[model samples]
Target: MTNQQLLTKPIGIDVNQVADSSSEEATKAESSKPELNSDEGLPLLLKAIIEGFVDGVLILTTNQEWFHANECGRRMCSQISQGKLPINSIPEPIWRVCQSLIDSREWFSDRKRFLEDEIKVNKSVEFRVRVRWLTLDLSRDPYLLVTLEDQHQSTKNSAITDVINYGLSQREQEVWLLKKANFTYEEIAHQLYISINTVKKHLKKIYAKQKQLMQH
Candidate 1:
């Protein structure tokens, strides 16, 4: 994929639209696999979105066959795309990205962890490759969602938790969240029905804990 192409980019699978086709591919490997279909309507939308992506978006089938690929995704489809050039051959950077995932799977066949790589595509472009495995039904192998992005900016979103992570106690966390929500010390004191001094003390300790976390 070109640097300019890595700028743009769903999980559901279609039950009916994909069922017959999935069964056929499932048979290609001489396996009796139950379908891992997403709801009919949702996956159709998903497939459309995935294929419409300018960024690389690929859906690995339960049998590791190519289920869907956008223009950018075709670049790395080589992992199984045979000798069809881009599909048959992956970019060197993306090759390592895929290798990490395959290696992790080989190391711990049962346990799984997400695999990722930030690879230099060119002097002007770096790419971040990410692969996430998904659930599958009986008689099938698990599938993967693969994405590629240019380094200028990351498209992947980091999940934010409602609760702040800390070694702080439950009450301390409560105080911290309140403070984060822009509650004043005196307001928090009234809400918790604690003395203003106690609120200040908790805030002090919370700041200390956060500082400690930052240090580590």
Candidate 2:
């Protein structure tokens, strides 16, 4: 359905009417008239528009505080939360993710996926977010359209293959031997005078190579 149709039908709000009217008119059409502190079903059409979208909709306050969220969005947030994340409640990880997004709009728009680094929800879920920038109203407030999707099996398999392709360098092998001898990557990095991320990258390469060889 069209965005207007969805909003007008589910939330029962007249977007055009609200568009022509004041922000107060638009607020009146929302469920519970939240900002105005009044209670009522948000215009059916508006509600439907959000709920029907493939992406989860989360409305945040001007202060960047959580205001409300749709079902899919709510579930996505809860999955990563390790517990229920009620309305208005924010998790630190999510907060960090949002901050990073706001900090790097370009990076935020194009999320990079790494092998075995797929963001997991709760424990073992592989989650990816497709986001779009949104401006809600006359106030020109900023919001985001975040779509939660599961990676295809082929994608995951390909990632493993890619990691294997970039397998360990000679210096990495030296670190791996020490790691096998119970040295932490940090300790190895310290001894090798390398950064922790570099050490981890090397180990990832080592791990993928070992898996590849074993498969052969």
CA lDDT of each prediction against the hidden true structure: 0.57, 0.53
Candidate 2: misplaced stretches above 4 Å?
A: 1-43, 84-87, 105-118, 152-216
lDDT (Cα, tens digit) per residue for candidate 2, span 105-142 = 45433333111113555323555643334444423455
55-130: candidate 1 lDDT, tens digit per residue: 6876564344555567766753443333445443444555555555556666666535656766654443456777
What TM-score should be assigned to candidate 2?
A: 0.41
Q: Top lDDT: which candidate number?
A: 1
Which ranges in model 1 have alpha carbons more than 4 Å from their true place? 1-43, 52-54, 61-65, 75-88, 106-112, 136-139, 153-216
TM-score of each: 0.41, 0.41
